[model samples]
Target: MPSATYASRRSELETYFDRTAVEAWARLTSDAPVSRIRATVRAGREAMRAELLSWLPQDLSGRRILDAGCGTGAFSLEAARRGAEVVAVDVSPTLIGLARARAADPGLPGRLDFRVGDMLDAALGRFDHVVAMDSLIHYRSGDIVRALAQLAARTDRSLLFTVAPRTPLLTLMHAVGRLFPRGDRAPAIEPVAEGSLRRRIAREAALAPLAVARSRRIARGFYLSQALELARR
Candidate 1:
């Protein structure tokens, strides 16, 4: 079960993505031109996604993958194209709708089963690999470890996720973001120290079967996030 804090944060995220910043998010994930700041974010996200994908096999023909917190479904689409059965899920109905709309092409290879719900839902079943992208960036370190533990329970091979890396620049930008009017502000990202996160993961009993495999930080202009991989031992 998710802790109360996790549930609350999930609600905040659903509202932010479904109602508050749906248009802005859609624009950011698309080819449509965006402001310079968003362009950097898009680029950074692309780089991170590519890095995560590179960790998986290029030919995923019998694999079952989970695209947890899948936003506009770019990563899910790619995984599906590589012949993985992908269950791309998100808490935002609007974002899921956009993903479904974008993936309407009948000729796309493999299958993309997009759902609107918590990515930690056990009903979603097991996966050979799970990619969380930037989904867990808003939660605290403990909550992140807990969430990963939950996902790790059903993940057979590996789990790929990203966190807002604690850094001078990111800390400054995060503080500045708080100054924005509450209504216009996105939910604050919770920057995490990589060392602390790794320690917590190590202490998590549910995560004991997984070992930290690979990690890389991607920082593009206003965007900064670290991708971490945990594979079954």
Candidate 2:
């Protein structure tokens, strides 16, 4: 079971996303539902997703994938569309509900098992790949160490997720961005020192990085993203 503090923080994050990011998250960035204020952020996500998906096998004909912390199911939908079986999960019921509805629509051709649960604690089966998008922002550095270990355990092929890179400039930017504030939001950005994060995971988790790329560059948002691609021990 997750601790009370974990549960509370998780709830706060879910509420924040459900209220703010979900609408834009559910839509393709080119679509009008993404606000001008949100478009740049959404664009960064879109770019990140496209690049990461390209890392998958050329033929994902019957691969199994886990989409941990799948918000609004954008990546889940895309993976399914590309012919992978996806188990998409989120801590937020609201986001899972949206994803379930989207997956249920007759036009989509893919198998999605959408569930609402804590990724760290879920008893989900193994998969060929595990892709967790921008979900690690919810965790502090210590918490993220645990989360990455779990993700590393479940994937036979590869695991991928994004983290805020802790550069002096980006750290300053995150602090500055928080001041403007979303009315219902609690502070969520947890930037990790790229060097330290890689070293720690290598030493502790034993999940070696196949590739680590900066997906969302400084131009996109105050929060920059680095996508870590890890392989089994």
Candidate 3:
């Protein structure tokens, strides 16, 4: 059973993202609405996705990739375009529908598959690489660790995912932001003792960390986002 925190986070994500996938992707800065932002935010998000893809290599031809929690199919479709077979999974049927719409191209049909499944309950098949991108942001620590182990088991090469690091500065920012949050935008973060969590995940999942880099898009004082790459044992 999913914890209350995990279930609440899933509900919030499904409610917010399902209604505005495109708008969310075009985030100008922090949590500002799309109408109040510039085109650069969209480009920035694309760049971040590119960075996420960078963990692998220049060429992904003939590779099998799992884009777990893929939102609107951005990274998943990109992988397909680069000659990889991708399985794109997400929890929101609305978001999955949007992804399916994007995969309508004649050339993309054979390259990828899109499905709706929660991270905790999904039965993912084997793959050369697994990436969760920023989708695990609000997940509970225990669930995240469980997902990591399962991802590690199915992946032949490596697994990549993002986490919201807890720092003193970020802790302060979140506290203040909550008092005066913008409209219905999500909180900057909830505390994730990143160091201890990393250690715990490594111990429980039997995976070794390859790299942990701060994401340029969300590493400001508000959200100290880090992309973690774990290699299979």
Model 1 per-residue lDDT tens digits across residues 1-233: 99999999899999999998989999999999999999999999999989999999999889999999999999999998898899999999999999999988677677999999999999999999999999999999999999999999999999999999999888888899999997888888999999999999999999999999999999999889999999999
Q: Estimate each model's TM-score.
A: 0.97, 0.83, 0.76
Deviation from native of the Cα of residue 42 in model 2, angstroms = 1.3
The number of the candidate with the highest lDDT is 1
Q: In model 2, which runs have C-alpha deviations exceeding 4 angstroms?
A: 1-8, 19-30, 105-109, 177-184, 205-223
lDDT of 3 by residue, 107-132 (tens): 75338888888754536678888888
| Model 2 worst lDDT window (10 residues) | 209-218
In terms of TM-score, the best-performing candidate is 1
lDDT per residue as tens, model 2, 1-233: 44565667787787776666665556643356755657777777877888678878755768999998888788888888887888998877878888787777555455789988877654888889888888886567666766777666677788888888777886786688777756645546777887787667757634554444334333466325778777653
State residue 148's C-alpha deviation in candidate 2, in Å.
1.0
Stretches of model 3 off by over 4 angstroms after superposition: 1-4, 20-44, 177-188, 191-193, 205-224
Ranking, TM-score, top scorer first:
1, 2, 3
Report, for all candidates in order, the number of backbone clashes. Answer: 0, 0, 0
Q: Write down the worst ten-residue block by lDDT for model 3.
A: 214-223
